[model samples]
Target chain A: MEPAVKKGPADILYDEVWELARTIVDARKQIGALRPSKLKTKNVSAALLEMDEIVKATEEASNTIMDSAEIMSSADASDAGYSALVQENCSKIFEACVFQDLTGQRISKVMTTLELVDTHLQDLQDLLGPEFDEPDDGVDEREGDEALLNGPALTDEAISQDDIDALFD
Target chain B: MTANKKDMSILIVDDYKTMLRIIRNLLNEVGFKNIDEAIDGVTALDSLRSKKYDLIISDWNMEPMTGLELLKTVRADATLTKLPFIMVTAESKTENVVAAKQAGVNNYIVKPFNAATLRSKLTSVIGEF
Candidate 1:
């Protein structure tokens, strides 16, 4: 027979909490790992400014985590009371904030990376011709890129160009 | 950060004036100039229709129109298809993330975020910085 699975109350709670915690941690680690290479591409002054913001945010998030841990440890998980409910809710709030904060950090990092990518893409595009920048001025090409990026229109309810023009007036 | 002359313009939309101002200031610290603000999604939609914004950062929960609704509208507009949109919210439930991802949000930010977190999310969503 297969062995029976077992998870204690504290074990379950910890697991749940840790699952979210791990997401936050892993995301932050990714951002941290990406930063050094990113800094290489940016100017010193800009890097310094970004580094300062990152450091301050890191410190603040650390404090929040510590506070959450303290709260979780002190709260009576077994107690079927209102205070316990409040504690649980508060704990969830903290975890959610952690994820949000981590995501925010990650987004900034991604943008910087994109900036680098855009620079590289622009360089490549420039090498081709002025047309590279205006690749889709035609209605069909413009429609194609739009549809490809944003998906198809919700409805097929068509209106004439004069109908649209009249509304513009 | 290598100064290649920051070209991005951020339009922050929130129901709360305080929140709008705060987000704008935070973007400023990130070396972003040409920041604009709107009090709610209605005003935001108007601004979005008339101007070309490189980025649209909006609060998720608002009166009349929420961030998700605005995001949907933005996605529907062919002129703004490639524009990156982010939803800033106090809701962080797992389902919320799933929903936002489904609604075509390029990224998300939770309320009470500090400078680093904000910067990081922008980097991850927009590029690797």
Candidate 2:
């Protein structure tokens, strides 16, 4: 019977590191597959593109309706009742523009998800040995300026324009 | 001489075309007719040099040069210093606000914002519309 050999701390640490590396690789693959630009089974890019089209179409339709209404209202012999109705309809079209705001929020969320995945992949690469020469993307050295470059605030965490105004006061 | 709010020549700098369009539309709603756009700070600086804009509204995060960089550049330039500059960003951090203020930003707006918020910011920086 062979004697049992106990693994040293270095050996145990190596195993743990390799395990982490594998898990990171798996996570990277999953994120890449799910990314919007991937165009895979669950592509978020497609949904965003579809929403973009919808927003464009809706805006165009709304603008056309508003233009026609304005022309009709300006006519010399425009009926008072019809003019009022046109104004009301135009107001509704303006309100319907709220879709752009909602869609903008959704697109921002998708962008955040993609950014998180990218950061994780970068962190993983840093943990492991560099596989390739580091490119001069200018981002790594530019970290100093990016400290205040935080992108849009989440709805719940966002401050109001009034609050900002009070800051100056 | 201060430009009238409605007639003010405005330059809007943002990396996102969607955001530029949204801001343009909001500006239109608020009666600003003359609006120009640049996709980044470098381009924005060029636009500022070529033409005189009554006001500048810029986003904070852009490649090559950021809105803060742009603001600092405008403030440093003898010709462009004192330009009414507004910084629009999603970052609501106190440090960022202080940095922008120290960099000579006339006002700061945090996203996502509506036409009313934009109007208020514009009014505060420029004057009553």
Candidate 3:
């Protein structure tokens, strides 16, 4: 307040640099917010694991029914009624395997999200332009495999098994 | 050129371990015994080079290489060109099917398939079970 100090180019440059630093800090916060939540991924992973166990259990149950049917059929031919019941139960177990399809679809969606996040992070990294080291050449590690990177289709968009079968005809 | 399903050496390629297990189980249900597995297309190509496989069942969405890429490579190779390759994928796009068909995939199976569908597809490709 004693005297008015005229800002020089150096001072202006310093302020500009400080503003850029602040902008970077803000960008970091924004990125942190934009990043895919680890909690969501963890939750999905846990659910998928549970689904897998359930699917395995169903498969095991179906196998047991088949084995039991085989043993009963070999041991005695008069147990047709019991065999029919077992077959019906096996069919139900097989139907339960549909969970695999649904879960697979869901998991694929999550994977797509993760992949998108990865791409964003990569893009951000490129924008930052190597704060510590030389800039990366922007080559994909799996560049040769890029052509094959088609992830799973969304459930609604996926072709039905019947449709695929029709191709054979 | 049908091979015995039980005796045929098959390679199952997929990025998902669960999928690999599911396919192995399904193949087992259909009487395929000599089955081996690869986690992705790279390993699949290596396996194919090392030893002969009667059939290949591969998932499309894989890293470092996809089932479609593997199919293209297989078709490009003189020795492996005629190998009976089946693509199993969750993708149902007509374009995807067209691409696979253009690449010379022996058969295609959409995901959420059961043993019956798999069996039928196998029959279609390898002929009569």
Candidate 4:
């Protein structure tokens, strides 16, 4: 067989760069121009705010239920106007149950955020490819968490603020 | 001017608008009307500097600057150190509570609380409403 041509360091570096560019092009095709800042501010923050609302709704509803139960328990039904008391408390319960509707809507918003994040993550996976797994080799999990603190990324491969928080956390 | 607790202006800080609204309503139930709002610690700090407040009720997990950081900053400042602060948290974690207490938080309120709990926490800090 003919002697094979040896590649220099410069040639090897060019090949690696070309490979990265190809991977990015492919990922861009998959993600269709991901606006990372939007993901952090609008998507993530909105989802979190929505989830907060859900928590508030849940807590308010439970509190209402408990308050009514306690009121009903403390007051005797045998006493005059007991039926009126029960009617008022039951009406409050009906009002509190409306929280379910708000919670459902908030959950839907969170789901949408998760789905979008998954798609963005798919972009990252594609760009990183199989080589992403190699970095974990011989790395302690706790050390890996520290290693993840790759500060503000370059504009070409920017991570959202939430992504940085995830890395730090 | 006499500093009446009921009429004293209060500053409420929470990143979430709904939480601010809930706290505002509860504070109303507690019979305090002059209230202001801040979205995060930075804004709250600014408000503290520009205007005087009787008490501060701040949520723990705010962005940019957390409530713990805010507390530390407040305590560090001789002017703001004496400001009565009641922290609000969704978590009942001992470590967090210890940290807040160490940072000089006057009191803390766990989430899902009602008017009574709010009033109770408020009472401990600023005296009975």
Per DockQ, the best of the predicted structures is 2
DockQ each: 0.02, 0.34, 0.33, 0.09
By TM-score, the candidates rank as: 2, 3, 4, 1
| Candidate 2 residue-wise lDDT, A1-169, digit = tens | 9998899999999999999999989877865654535543344555567567666756665565555555554555556677676677677667767766766776776676567667756765665547654657766354555766667666676667677777787
Candidate number with greatest lDDT: 2
Clashing pairs in 2: A152-B90
Q: Cα lDDT of all candidates, in order?
A: 0.66, 0.79, 0.77, 0.77
Clashes of each: 36, 1, 0, 0
* Model 1 chain A poorest 10 in a row by lDDT: A144-153
Superposed Cα deviation of residue B113, candidate 1 (Å) = 0.2
Pairs with backbone N, CA or C atoms under 3 Å apart (clashes), candidate 3:
none
Worst lDDT 10-window in candidate 1 chain B = B1-10
| Model 2: residues with Cα > 4 Å off, grouped in runs | A1-143, A155-157
Q: Look at candidate 3 and tell me the lDDT of residue B22.
A: 77
Model 2 chain A weakest lDDT span, ten residues long: A34-43
Q: Model 4: how many Å of interface RMSD? A: 14.5
Q: What tier of docking accuracy does candidate 3 attain?
A: acceptable
* Best by the TM-score measure: 2
Model 3 lDDT per residue over A38-132, tens place:
63576446556766766676566556545554444344446657667666666765665676676677667666656766776776676566884
Please say which candidate is ahead in DockQ: 3 or 4.
Answer: 3
In terms of TM-score, how similar is model 4 to the real structure?
0.51
Q: Locate the minimum summed-lDDT window of 10 residues in model 2 chain B.
A: B1-10
As for model 1, its CA RMSD to the true structure in angstroms is 27.1
